[model samples]
Target chain A: MTLHIAVLVVLLGLFFVLPAYHVGAFSRIMVLAIYAMGYNLLFGYTGLLSLGHAMFFAAGMYGFGLTVNLFGFSVAPAFLTGIIAAAALALIVGYLALRTAGVAFMIVTLMFAQTVYLVILYFGEYTRGDEGFVVQQAQRSFAGIDLTGETERYFAALILFAICFLAVAKLVQMPFGKRLVAIRENEERARMLGYDAAKLKLHALIISGAVSGIAGATYGLLFGYVGASFSTVQYSIFPLLWVLLGGAGTTIGPLIGVIFMFYLIDISSGYTDAYLLIAGVALVLLTLFAPLGLVGTLRKRAFPWLP
Target chain B: MLASLEGAVISAILVLTAMGLSIVFGVMRVVNVAHGEFFMLGAVLAWVVTTTLGGHPVFGFVAALIVVPVLVGCIAAGADRLILKRVNYDPDRTIVATIGMLYIIQQATLMTYGPEARPVEAPFNTRLSLPWFEFGDEGFQMIWPWGLSITSYKLFVIFAAIAVLIALWIVLTRTKIGLIMRATQQDSDTAQAFGVPVGKVYSWVFGLGAGLAALGAVLVVPIQQAHYLMGGDPLLLAFIVVIIGGLGSLPGTVIAALLIGMSDGIISVFFSPTLAKIIATFLVAMVLVFRPQGLLGRAPS
Candidate 1:
């Protein structure tokens, strides 16, 4: 318990202080962490690997963008609308995709996400296509308070991240989470045990979709722009990497992985033009040496005391 | 009329890439996400040999078709021995690992080649013209038989792709190594128990897949320029093909590839490219929902 509190304190302190030195990097880390956490709920806990998570993320961004630019909604309302739209999209996609498990599920989700990406890419009129949608001013105000400043947005993101993290943690401990775990471990056995595997998967996917949508909304709001690139297959794959690198089953793993990966990319980009190469090398090394991920390694080494 | 030929040409290219992808997936149960990267690598190497070394483009392409696969195949063999060998039969971990490999290879290519599209001119540019027919304000010109008006290069691509597919079919059906591969794919553990070197077979299978992808790249480079990011478009299409055909069924993959390629080509020609992709993707999702084992894939026993 003391360890958990201490860790949280250290994390929160780092989050608040890091922006002082590098605001952009810090924001990137937070947003990615949020995204990874959302992914963690579906992949790490629920045992459903969704390769097209970017669909929900992009849906949220587009939802928010459309609401703000087209409908003239306020930032808060637009954000809510984005979440709702993402949830709806997730429900539909999940319904069809969750029918298959493992590789098929991964490919199906990826196909859908890529389709969305292509749609956005070719339909230049509505999405502004490849050129992307830009926010003219970052000075989004909520109830007349300027929420556009970096510090304000950063704090807002942090608060939202915390809430999302807590929500996911809670969901994982619930009955549905247990069913998800059962399905992950052995679908046949779970079905024999009388659990509706598809329904459980759907539930988990919806939650996953909602969380990913929130992450996308936060990303758009923070960056003050959104584009088709956000919906690409690569973007969809990032959270999966984060979940894997962090140790999928653990609550803190995704967050830890996100922070580590974001920093790795940020730091490596400065040294070499081949940031992707460095990151890829790191991933290969991690997968080869530490399949269980960094958190798993740490837990094995340091905390033999906990479950 | 010309559009139909263009569609046929594009379909042929897609079929070639998809066939290699399908065979690899069928034999190895490994969804080599890096397959497209191998294709791109072949194109890049071919471009280098032809343009940088001042070699004949055709010879360079042929060299790439032979060499790139051997090189990538060796790397894939290493991947099999060092990485995939460990995660054998664990589909989830394998998928994750392959995705990791995909990113690594993609980035490595980008680092080596830079993120730019380099044009590799085809060795030949012979267009065949037939008797012209008059249309409203335009003359309907026929270039080839069956109302198909396609460039000679495209015709070459079609013939080459068909030849490769037929050759692959023969190899898979007739050869001793092919027999072993079939046995291994059917049941790796059983095959190993029966004295087949499953490890060697796996290495060979990985190499074979990489080689096929490289061959496709050699064939395709003229159509689409050799670019660092060239693999992405084809990779998505290949994935769709693989899913539609069934995960590990080569014939199924071929059929799915043709179906998807033709539909995608036709749709892109008639409607918006975006809508075509959406339709194709919708088909995949529908297939998954209705036939999770795929069009020809058998359910895991």
Candidate 2:
């Protein structure tokens, strides 16, 4: 817990010390890390590999985006609406998807996400189809504080990240989180021990979805744009890649993964237009040499007390 | 009637693409997310070959039909040897690796091919008018209907797919190679114990799977323009077909392809294309929820 707080303190200090460009980048990475963290909840701890998490992220984004854009809802209510939308989506998706396991689960989530994407496109009048609408600068304020200001946005993102980070850290140490890990390790054995695997998984998914929703809502609110691109299969894959890279089942792995990936792309984009090529090659290499990921490898080799 | 014809064409292409995915999945037990990229590569390579040949469209088309699949097969085999083999084909690792491969292939194509959708001229695109049968007072009269014609190339594609599928069926059931493949698929460790080169077989199967996707793309390029992004839809549709058909079942893949392709065509006639896709995607999810093993797939042991 002291280590976690120290890490937060360092992040807080970095905002003051770092240049403008990096501060902005750090803000974005912190928000995305939250998404990756949410993904890690189910994928890392629960051992459920979903290929359609973008829907939850989009659920929050579009929920917040649509409510604010269409209904003229304020930021606070719109954010709540976004989280609610994602949780609801997670409920429906989880109910249907949980019926299948393994590769079927992956495929089911993928198809559902595709359906959600298509539905968004079908209602182009509201969504503007592929070209998304932007939230007005005037409407994006929380309790009279302007979120568009760089310093304010960075602090806002940091606060949200700290809350989620600490909550997830605390949650994983509890029995419920341990049970989730137990399910991940061996679902059959966990069930035999009288734990309701189905209900546990459902609850995990909902919490995962709701957290992802919060990230999604915060991302749109802070960045001031909501687009359908967030719901693509590519987007779904991002968290998986991040979780895998950082170290699954680790509290801080998602942050590390997001920071590494964000910068890898950011740095590579300076040299070439095909920056994703670098990401692709990095993934292949990571799988080849470091399949356990950075934090995973660290835990294996050096620090056994990483969490 | 027109919808059915269009559906048949789509089914023909889908069968080839999905069969490749199914075969690889059945034998290797790994999903190649890069399969569609292979399909896109086939069309792109076909374009490059045709543009360079600078002769009759037929010559380039035939050469591409013969060469692109082989070329793509080699690439896929190389990838298997380099990356997949190193990972030991662990399912999760394979997925991540293939997704990496997907990005690599897509980005490379984007860099080289650019974003424009390029067309490959059909070797033979003469429209063949169809005669519709009418039951009237005159009794059993045949009338030629306007705009109810298909390009000869489309008919050729249908025939070619049938021939390939038949050839595939024979190779899988009647030949020694087929027996060895089946043996490997049934139990790789046992097959290896029996002196089968399982590693070599894996490489070959990956190549063959990719070759089949390439073949499908080659055939479809003239009907639909060759674009780097064209692979996405086919990949999704192939996944739906493969799952609906019961994973790696060949016959099931074909039947499901037909069902999906036909329904997609028919649905588009009544609903907007996006709406049709929405319905199809939702239905597939429900099907998986209800029957995870799929229509013809055996229950997991």
Candidate 3:
């Protein structure tokens, strides 16, 4: 618990102070960590592999983008709208997808996500297609604060992440979280025990979707734009990688994975522009040998006395 | 008339890709997400051979039909032996590992070929017009003085795909190796206990599926051209086919492929392409909800 608190404090401090050291890299890492945590809840804890997480994430971005740019809504409402839109979308999609389990579920959800992506891509008149959406300076302010500025955006993102992290931590300790674990362990048994497996999965999906939505909304607000690329299949896989790399089923694992991946990519993009190859190799190795993930590995090593 | 032929041609192309995915999933129970990457590799290889080796494009195509699958098959076999075999039937880990493999293969291709799309020259480009077909001031016209017209390349694709399907059916049903593969699909442990070399059978099945995908790649190059990312689209389409066909059901896959292919082609022709995809995906999701086993798939035992 102390370790967790310490890590949280350090992360919060980094979010506030990192802009002084380096603006773009630090902010990017923070957003990615938040995104990974959302993914970790669904994949790591719930054992549901969602290949289309970017759909929810992009939903937030587009929701914020549309409300702010086209409808001229305030930033707070835009962010809330993005989260609501993503949650609603997740509810519908999850209701359908969670009906089936295993590979069928993964493919179905992914296809649905890809379908949305195609719609966004081809409906050029609305989405601007590949060109993407740009946010105006006037649109970036929340009351008196200028969100367009990096420091303000970073702080805004930090607040959202802190709230989401607390909510997830609390939820995971509740009875609902135990049911999720039961569902993950043995779906048939869970169903036989009178647990509404589908409903539980849907709950997790919605929570996962809501968190991802916030991440996406934050991304758009901070970056001051959104685009079709944000919702592509590549983006869908990003969270999965983070979950696996950091350690699925562990709270801190995803954050670690996201930070590591972000830094790795930032550094690698400078050298050969083949960050994907490196990431892929790392993922394969981790999946093969360290399936418990980084935190799981640490737990095993440090707690040799307990077991 | 030409529209019908066009539909037939497109259906044939989709079937080729779908069948390979079906076979791999059906036999090995490993969803080869990288299957489409093999197809892309085939197209790229054909282009390289034809352009560089100074041969007929058909010869290059044939070479790709053999070489690309063999190369990818070896990699897949290694993946199965080194990683997948350990995980066995654990779908979650297997899916993640395969996804990891997908990224590795995709990035490798990108690294080698770069991100730009490349074109492969078709061996034959001539259009074959039937004497019976004709069109007038009306929106449409038909046969016998306005009969059917088709591209020679499309006809070739249809013929090639049919031939491959026939060959696959024969291999799966008539051969001893095919029997072993069928047995393994039915029950891996029982097949092994019954003296089937389960390991070798898996490698062979993976190779066979990869080869079929490569064949699809070679056939479609004339129409779609070759590119690094060409595989991603087909991969998604194949996944839909597998789901609708029912897992491990070969005949079911064939029917599902035709259904989806025709639906996609016809719907896209009539409506916006984006709307067509959304509709198709929606239909699949509905089917999954109501009948998870698919059109012809038996209930999971």
Candidate 4:
């Protein structure tokens, strides 16, 4: 844990002080890390692989961006609304999704996610469809800090990531977290043990959704853009890959996964336009050979307390 | 009438693809997410062959019809050996693996064919007019519908799908290989005990499923145009059909495809295309909620 904090401090220094640090990329990594953290709670720990978390993420982005851009709301209010919107969406999608299990859940969530994407696209006049929407007032000062300032944006994302990391860490250690694990291990057994598996799964979904929303809002703020693109299956897969690649159920695994993938993509993007092909190949290889992912495999093979 | 005809054409295309998907699901219990990429491959291959031939459209199309599916089947068979076997058809893992395959195929196509949507010239496009009788001031007057006329190619597509499906039915029923496949599908361990080559059967099944998708793509590319991105909609539609129709039931698959096809045609023409998609996607959620076993699937004991 101390090591984790030390790493965070060094990252903060790089973002705030180091001239060589790419704040834009760091900010993106932090935002996605938060998203992956939320995803891990459901997928890694709870063992529910939702292929439609993009809906919640998109909801958060659109909620935050639209509120700030259209309703003239301040940053704090918009941020809260984004999380709320995502949690609320999770409530609806989770309720509907929990009616099924396994593959059905995956397909149902995917279909519903596509539904959301189509809805957003149909309302292109408002959301700007394929072209996407830019938040003109995204640079507006919030809490006496200039959000337009690179360091300020980076710090904002970093602080959010820290809170999320702590929250996920604490949540997984609680009794509720144990219940999530039990459900993941065996839902029928958990149910026989008098635990409400459905309710617990729903709780995990809601928490994950809200965290993803927070990440999405941060992404919009840092980049000043949000669009229907976020609602696609591709976006949902990003977090899944990150969680799986880094290590699901491990708090620091998500950060490691997101950072590693981001850097890999960044470096390779210059060489080939088929960078997505690389990502695809990596996913297949990892799923086939390294199911436990980088951190999970390492912990199992050698270091028990790698995280 | 025209809307329903359009629906039939769409359903024909769907059946060609979804049957392969359903067979894979039935035999291996793996939901191949990259199944749509086969459809894209079919169209791309067809485009390559037809464009390369560059002479009589009929000759070029006929060559594509024969060659594209065989080529796609070989690729899928190779993939099954290389990747699916390693994963051992683990349901969840296969989904991700197939998704990865989807991207690899999509990006490879983008690199090779570029990003442009290309049209394949139809062998023949003779538009036949339909006569409609309307009561005017003088009474019943016969008039030919203008845009209601459809090219003969669409009719050929519907007929072609029917023929292929019939051939598939025959192969599954009359052939010894079909018996082996059925045995493998029913009980893999027992089939293996009986000296049936389960691995070879799996590769063949995967190839067959991919071939169906390719066949459908080759038939439809004349109307829809060929693009690397065109596979997504067909893939999603195939999933809905396979799920709703009952994953291993070929008859059920055809029935559900027809239902969705007709509805897609009527709804998109009268309402809006987006509305049709919304309703269809929404229906999938409902189907999962109320009837997870699907329409024709046997209930689990």
Candidate 5:
């Protein structure tokens, strides 16, 4: 664990010190990694494959942006507001969607997420509809730092990502995390064992939503823009791809997956417009040949205690 | 009266598309997320055939109708053998694989056909003004209702959907292949033990399902322009209908399609399209909560 942290620290340090090559781009990846990790909490650890995490993420972005725009809130306060709104949104969506199991759950979440998107698009006055909203400048940062500056934004994203990652790590070691795993493995069995499986799943969903919301807030802050595109069904599926690619149920796997995919898209888009073809083919091939993804594959073949 | 007629047309299209999805889910237990892409491909095929022949629109449309569904069916069958067979129909994994398939097919179309929306000229497009009846002292008065007109091609679509559905019913009930499919759907292992070629049946089912969806696209593309990205909405709508009708229930799927289609048509006509979508999606969520088995769906054992 310490070794992994040591490596992450050095890697982040390089990004911070070295010439700031596309720092915004790297910041985007960090934000996405944070989003993916939040998704992994529900999908990987708790075994709930939600199709509407985008709703939570977008809720965070729009919520935070709205607070800043309307209420004149600063960075951290607006970010908190955005995340709390996302968690609340998750509570409602999850409660409604979790009524059914398996495929029903996936489809229900999908429909609800899409419905939220329609609502957002319909209420264009607030969301700006297709026009989208420009994120207000964060007037204040933590302890006298200027968040509006580009380099400062990168550090803010990096710091938030680390905090969320560590929080996940600590939580997964506790009894609550063990209960989540139990629910994931066999909800029926867990219920038979007297666990409040639904409540536990709900909690996991809220935490996951909150984390994803924070990532969305960070993304809005870093990019200074928010759009309905982020809440699309495509974006909902995007995190699933990242989690699957990284090997679900692992802390480092999502980060690895995000890094690889981010660069994959970045590099491939330069070569051809059909780079999505590669991502598509990769998804099919991976599901067929490498269902466990990078971390799971390594755990099976080499370092067995990877998670 | 015009709204109801339009609703019937919409229901016809929905029935055609959702039946294919229900059949595929029932027999193969794989939700082909790429199913909508087949519909898009069918429309593209229709456009290609129509434009290339460049003679009488009727002649070109006929050629497209005959060739497009079969071609799409073959493609689907090939996909089944190569990809789905390899994946072995694990629901979650198959979902992702089909999403990949969706992106592949969509991008392939975009690359080949370009990103422009292509219009298919209807073979016959004589507009017919619908007559409305109002209750009066004379029991009923035939009155022209506010200049509501429909194209002949749309009427053909309504008839074609019904004919195709009836033919499908005969095939499923009266034909040997249909019997094979139903038996396989009911219990694959049992059917296999009884000398049914379950693998062949699956491929045939997948092809038939895609072919049906393609046929719907072919019928409707003349009215609505065919584009690479147009597959997503139909796919989502079909899934909503299929899920509500209960996965793998043909009659349930058909009924659900009619309900959704009629409502969608009428709502969009009277209210906003976006509101119609919201209502439909909300209904799906409600069904999932209140009655997961759907209107006519059989309960899982």
Candidate 6:
């Protein structure tokens, strides 16, 4: 816990010391890291690998974006609506998807996500289809502070990230999180011990979805744009990649993974247009050499008490 | 009627692609997420061959039909040896590796193909009108319909797919390689003990699967334009077909492809294409949730 707080304190300190460009980049990474953290809860701890998490993220995004645009909702209510939308979606999807395990689960989630994406496209008049609508700068202010400003946006993102980070950290150390890990390690054994595996998984998915929704809502609110592109399979894969790279089941790993991937792409795009090629190669290499991921490898090799 | 014909063509292509995926999944127990990329590569390579040949369209098309699959098969085999073998084909790692391959392939194509949707000229295209039979006072006379017609190329696709399926059936059943492949699929450890080269068989199966997808793409490229992004739809549709048909069942795959392809075409006629896709995707997910073994697959022991 102290280590997590120290990490947050250092992040706060970095905002003041770092240059302008990095601070902005750090803000975006922090937001994305929250999404990764949410993904890790179900995937890392619960051992459910979903390929359609973009649906939840987009649920929050569209919920927030649509309510604000169509209904003239204030930021606070719009954000709540986004999170609720995601939670509701998670409830339905989790209930259905949890029926199938392993590869089928992956496929089910992937197809459901595809349906969400298509639905978004079908209602192009309202959602504006592929070309998404921008959240207006005028409506972005909350509590007498404009979120569009760089400093304000950074702080807003930081606050959200810190909250989620602490919650997930605390949750993982709790008995509930331990049970989830138990389920992950051995579902049959966990069930034999009288734990309701289905209900536990469903609850975990909802919480994970809500956290992802929070990130999604905050992302649109802070960055001031919501688009259907964020709902793509590519977007779904991003969290998986981040979680895998950062070390699944680790509290701070998602943040490290997000930052690592962000800079890898950012730095590579400067040299070539085919930056995704570099990412692909990195992924292949990681699977080959670092299957456990950075944090996972660290835990395995040294500092077993790190988590 | 037109929608059914179009669906038949789609089903034909889907049979080849989905069959490829099914075979690989059955034998290797690894889902190649890059399967669609291999299909895209086939279409792209077809374009390259046809354009560069600059001869008769038939000659170019024939050359592509013969050469593209072989080339793609070799590439897939190389990938299997390099990446898949190293990972030991663990299910999760295979997915990630294939996704990485997907990115590499897609990005490379974007860099080379330049993001344009390029069309390949069919070897031959002739519009053939059809007669409608109607009972009249003059007694059963065939009347020419105003709008009922199909191109020679579309009909050819249907025939080509049938020919390919027949040939594939024979290869899988009648040949020594087929026997080996079947043995490996049933029990790789036992087959290996019996002196079957399991590793080599895996590489060949991977190659064959990719080759089949490439062949499908080559055939369809003339009908639909070759584009870097065209693989996504086929991948999703093939996945749906594979799951609905029951994994690894050849006949099931063919039947499911027809069912799905026909519905996709007919649904588009009644509803918006996007709506059709949403419905299909949702229904397929429901099927997997309820009938995880698929429509024809035996329940796992």
Q: Rank by DockQ, highest first.
A: 6, 2, 4, 5, 1, 3
Taken over the whole model, the C-alpha lDDT of each candidate is: 0.77, 0.94, 0.79, 0.89, 0.87, 0.93
Error of 4 at A259 (Å): 1.1
Query: Model 6, range A1-307, lDDT digits (tens) per residue?
Result: 9989998999899899999999999999999999999999999999999999999999999999999999999999999999999999999999999999988899999999989999999999999989999999988889899999999999999999999999999998998999999999999999999999999999999999999999899989999899999999999999999988999999988999999999999998998788888778877888888987899999999989878
lDDT for model 2, please: 0.94
Cα lDDT, model 4, residue A55: 91
Q: Candidate 2 lDDT, tens digit per residue, B190-293? A: 99999999999999999999999999999999999988788898898898999899988999999999999898867888999889889989999998999988
Tens-digit lDDT track of model 4 for A1-307: 6767886898788775656357778887899999999999999999999899899899899888888888888888988899999999999999999898888899999988899999888888788886898877544568777776677778888898998988888899899999999999999999999998989999999999999999888888777889898999999899999998999888888999999899888998899888898889889899889999999999999999765
Q: On residues A227-263, what C-alpha lDDT tens digit does candidate 5 reach at each position?
A: 8889998889889999999998888888888888888
What proportion of true contacts does candidate 3 retain?
Answer: 0.53
Q: Compared with the true structure, what per-residue lDDT tens digits does model 1 show for residues A54-97?
A: 99999888888877877778888889988898889889998787
Q: Cα RMSD (Å) between model 5 and the true structure? A: 2.0
Native-referenced TM-scores of chain A, all candidate models: 0.92, 0.99, 0.94, 0.96, 0.95, 0.99
lDDT (0-100) at residue A186 of candidate 3?
87
Q: Show the lowest summed lDDT stretch of 10 residues, model 4 chain A.
A: A137-146
RMSD of 2: 1.3
Q: Alpha carbon lDDT of residue B48, candidate 5?
A: 94
| Model 3 segments more than 4 A misplaced | A15-23, A192-194, A303-307, B133-148
Estimate the TM-score for candidate 3.
0.93
lDDT of 5: 0.87
**What's the CA error at residue B157 for candidate 4, in Å?**
0.9
Q: What is the lDDT of candidate 4?
A: 0.89
lDDT of 3 by residue, A1-307 (tens): 4555676688667765664646566667668777888888888778888888999998988988888988899889998999999999999998888877777788777877887787788777878977898978888888889987767876776677667776777777789988988888888899999999888889899989988998898888888878999898889888988878877877777778887888788788787756688777876787788888777787777853210
Clash totals for all candidate models:
0, 0, 6, 1, 0, 0
Span of ten consecutive residues with least summed lDDT in model 6 chain A? A278-287
